[model samples]
Target: MKRNIAVVWGGYSSEIVVSAKSMAGICSFLDEEKYNIYKIRITKEKWTVEVGGYVYTVDKNDFSYICPISDQRIYFDFAYIIIHGTPGEDGRLQGYFDMLGIPYSTCGMMASALTMNKFICNNFLKNFGIRVADSLYLNKDTKYNLRGIEEKLKFPLFVKPNTGGSSFATTKVKAVDQLQQAIDAAFGETPDVIIESFISGREVTCGCYKTKDKEVVFPITEVVTPNEFFDYEAKYEGQVEEITPARISGEMTDEIQRLTRKVYDLVGAKGLIRVDFIISDNQPFLLEVNTVPGMTQTSFIPQQIAAAGLDIKEVLTEIIENEFNAI
Candidate 1:
């Protein structure tokens, strides 16, 4: 029997549009003979599935799509979460699915919760000898010591939402005067903000995933942005150059890939994860880990997948089959 696959996309954050595009790209390659694909658009307004221009509401309790014509409750056998932020990426949806005994295609509740917080994950990796930049953690209501923060971390700082992705509200502060405005802007996205000292170096990212058999690491991609950094514009727009199998030395590539796997194991992440790094003075600094990385025309995962001499269909199939067979 062909298993029903629910491609859960959209979210309660700015990354929802990107998530929709990702779902479309992945769905385009999904083999229809072996599996039945259902596009579940999740948002603050409604949880629905549209078929042939007809919208059917999904039963949140049992995770079933209600058929408008016959009123049949179609339950999904597997859920492929492509949402990049909030409920999908931050563990809320994962936890809900957990309660229903439904398996998903991303990290579990705890791992998602831990990794979505940049301060916690980076500091945790720091303990494992993975170097991360010195940063100040701040909450919306917490009193921030600006003088103390400035004294500890030098100028040319990066202020970003600790729990947000796609560089939604991230800012690069070149001077001390621009700190407050950046913090305020970051707070608009999430409740917490991380202010880290800038590390000038070659920006590169490597993606890794695991199966029941072994872990798979893709070739590293070098990110050369004409902007201030690899911000939203550089990532989604055509403001940056992403070179796969980066121009870095073989030794550095091996080290970052090793570190990337270690971080994945450390966070207990499932599915594919992209780890960003900054190699400054020949030392690789861990920037951040993307649990649900992009899959659009300009995304790095597809580029890395091709550079590694692998097919997107097989790679995505391996991911889906691994989860489906387990159940």
Candidate 2:
């Protein structure tokens, strides 16, 4: 029997386009013969699925839908969440699926919620001996001390939405005068924001996923961007160069893979995730953990999977089947 798989996309954030692209990429990677795939598009308005050339509404009661033509109800066996922001990446969708006894392809509720907040997640990992850049957190109602921030941290800080992704409103502040404007820009996207001391060095990322049978950690990728930083444009606009099997020492690759596994276990992450880092003074500083990483063909995970000489189709199958085996 073929299992029904929901490639859930769209969210209550600006990353909807990225999520849509990821949905297409995932659908292409999954083995069509083994699973009955459906493109489940979600938004603030409604939850829907496209059947044939017509769109049908999905029942939120049990995550099933009735085929008007056949008068048959179709239920999803699993959910492959690809939303990059709120309701999906922040754990809301995971909690919903958990209550319904439906497995998903991402971190659990706690892990998703914990990792969505950059400030809290980094601080939590810091306690586990994870090296992270010094950072400060701020909310829309809180009063931040700019002078204190400057004194405690170095110049050229990164101002970003504490709970946002796709570098939507992230900014690099090189001077005190640019601080206020950067903060405003980040606040425009999210109510809470973070300011972190910039780490200067080569930037690299590693993707990993652990199933019940195997621990797969992909090759590292170096991020080279001409912009001030790896901003929104660089990530989705093809303005950056992502070099796979990063031109680093073999020892460095081992260290990164070790840290990647450690972080995955520490965060209780499920499915595939990408951990970003900046090597300064030969030490890898944790940047941020992406629970619902981009799965587009050009995304880092696909690139790394190819670099590792593994078949993407088999990789997706392993992850999907792992969920059923765990249950």
Candidate 3:
């Protein structure tokens, strides 16, 4: 029997366009014979499902995907959420799906919510012996004091939104004068922000997945962006070069993979995830873990999957199957 799989994308996030692109990639790669795929677009006002190459707009109040032929409603057997940020990655939509009793690919509500906040997530992992960069959390309600920051951390610090992705509001400030401006920009994007000591090191990431009884980690990917940092343009505009199986020592590679799996288990994550890190002073520091990673043509997960000599579609199918059987 062919199960109905709903590939959900496009949410109220700054990464909405990126999410749509990822949804396209996922729909194209999903197996056609084993499952009946439905491309569902989640907008602010309505939820529409594409079936038989035609789009049918459904009410957002009701969770049913209306069948045009039978005039009956069909619920999704499983949902593959490709939305990258905001409601999708921040556990809002995941909680809604949980209430609906639907199985979706990705971590549960708590893990997703915790990992979405960079400050809280990194601090939580520190108890498990994870090395994160030295950072100070601040919010709009807090007092702005540059002298304290200057005393605690050196120049060339990174200012970023604590809850956003795609490097949307990330800036590197070299001097004290630029600190306030950077914070303003970051705060414009999110209420909470963090300022961290910038480390001059190679940026690398690793992808991981878990099945019913086993976990598999993919090769590390080294990211080289043309800009000062891996910001929005570098991430989405092809202003960067990504190398799979990062050109690093064998020992470093093994250590990163080990840390990746450890953090995955630490956060109690399931399905697919991408762990970002930086190698500084011959040591790896945990940056963040993405629960809903992008699946675009240039996305890191697909590249790593290709490097591992595995079909992307097959891997996604296995992930969905695992989610189905886990229930």
Candidate 4:
């Protein structure tokens, strides 16, 4: 019997467009013969499932959809989560799926929550002796010591939303004068933000995933952006050149892969994830882990996957099989 697979996309986050694109790519590659796929679009306004040019409202009680024409109810056997932020990336959706006993792609609840918070995740990695940028955390209501931040971190720092990704509301301040405005912008995105001392180095990222049979790491990619940093435009637009097999040495690649696997295990990450890093003074500093990495043609994960001599069909199959076996 063919299993029903729901590719859940869209969330109450700025990355909804990216999530929608990710699901579109994923849906195309999943072997249609083996599984019946449906695109479940979720938003703050509504969660609906489209089938045969008709849309049906999702029954949140059981995550099922009833066809209006036939009045038939359909339930998914598995869920492929692609929502990039909030509710999805932050573990709320995972928790809901857990209660419904539906296996979804990506990490479990606790792991998702831990990794969504930048300050907490970076500090957590420090326990394993992983190098990360020095940062300060600020709440929306607190009085931040701007002078202290300037004194300790110096100029050329970053202000970013504490829990958001895609560099949404992220600002790079090269001088003290730009600090306040950046903070306000970051706070506008989220109530909490992290201010970090800039780590000057080559920006590279490694994609990895662990399955029941084995663990796999894709080739590292070097990010060279024409902008000030790998911000929103650089990531989604033509403002960046992402070089795969990252013009680095064998030693560097091995080290990065080792760290990648180690962090994957440390965070108990499942499915595919991309870990960003900055190599300075010949030492790699952990930037962030994307549990739900992008799947678009221009995204880094797809580039890394292709560079590894593997296609998305095989890669996603392995991940889905692993999740199926676990359930």
Alpha carbon deviation, residue 312, candidate 4 (Å): 1.0
Please list the residue runs of candidate 2 whose C-alpha ends up more than 4 Å from where it truly belongs after superposition: none
Q: What's the lDDT for residue 167 in model 3?
A: 87
Best by lDDT: 2
In the range 7-118, model 3's lDDT, one tens digit per residue, is: 9998876788889889988988899999988888887877889887888885555466677799988877888999887788889988988988889998999999999999
* lDDT score at residue 283, model 2, on the 0-100 scale: 96
Report the Cα lDDT for candidate 1. Answer: 0.90
Higher-TM-score candidate of 1 and 3: 1
Q: lDDT of each prediction vs. the true structure?
A: 0.90, 0.94, 0.89, 0.91
Higher-scoring candidate on lDDT, 2 or 3: 2
List TM-score per model, in order: 0.97, 0.98, 0.96, 0.98
Q: Give the TM-score of candidate 3.
A: 0.96
Q: Which stretches of candidate 1 lie over 4 Å from their true place?
A: none
Least lDDT summed over 10 consecutive residues: which range in candidate 2? Answer: 145-154
The deviation in Å at residue 104 for candidate 4 is 0.6
Local accuracy of candidate 1 as per-residue lDDT tens digits, 1-327: 998889999999888978988998878767788889999999999999877788788888799976767877799988889999899988899999999989888999999988899999999989989999999899967897777778899888899999999989999997778889999999999999999999999999999999998789999999998898988888877899989989999999999999999999999999988999999999999999889888875689989999999988888889989987777
List CA RMSD, all candidates: 1.1, 1.0, 1.5, 1.0
